[model samples]
Target: MSFVLLVTLTVIEIVLLVLVLAIMVTMVTRQLRSIAANLARVAFGVRAVETQVSAIGPGVTEVNRLLRDINGTLPRVAQRAEQLAR
Candidate 1:
């Protein structure tokens, strides 16, 4: 009789432990998925910034080249105009 009682109690304890462990594992997996989703969002933002920067490159290059050309000839042109006026 005592042996039967001990066996039943041990089985009940094992069942409760398994239930608690299962709940804990489920909670951990859910948190990990949430973290992964947040990281994916951050990666998407970085890619968008990269694409926008690349899109602006051609316009920026054109502006820089235009400034360089104007700078190289504007002073000489101004001197020629002054000489002609005099």
Candidate 2:
């Protein structure tokens, strides 16, 4: 009698433990899927940024060249202005 009751209780406990483990596994699977989707979106966004930067590369170089030209002429313009003031 007591032995049968003990065996039955042990079986119930094992079943409950298995149920709990299954629920945890299901929740973990869902969270992993969510993380994978977010990572994919981040990857796509990074690719778009790379494309835009590459497209702007030539314009950036042109602007830098124009700035250098302006910088070179500024000193001569300042000297001319000084002469005019004198």
Q: How many backbone clashes does candidate 2 have?
A: 0
Q: How close to the true structure is residue 53 of candidate 2, measured as C-alpha lDDT?
A: 90
lDDT for model 1: 0.98
For all predicted structures, in order, the TM-scores are 0.60, 0.68
Please, what are the lDDT tens digits per residue for candidate 2 over residues 1-86?
69999999999999999999999999999999999999999999999999889989899999999999999999999999999999
lDDT of each: 0.98, 0.98
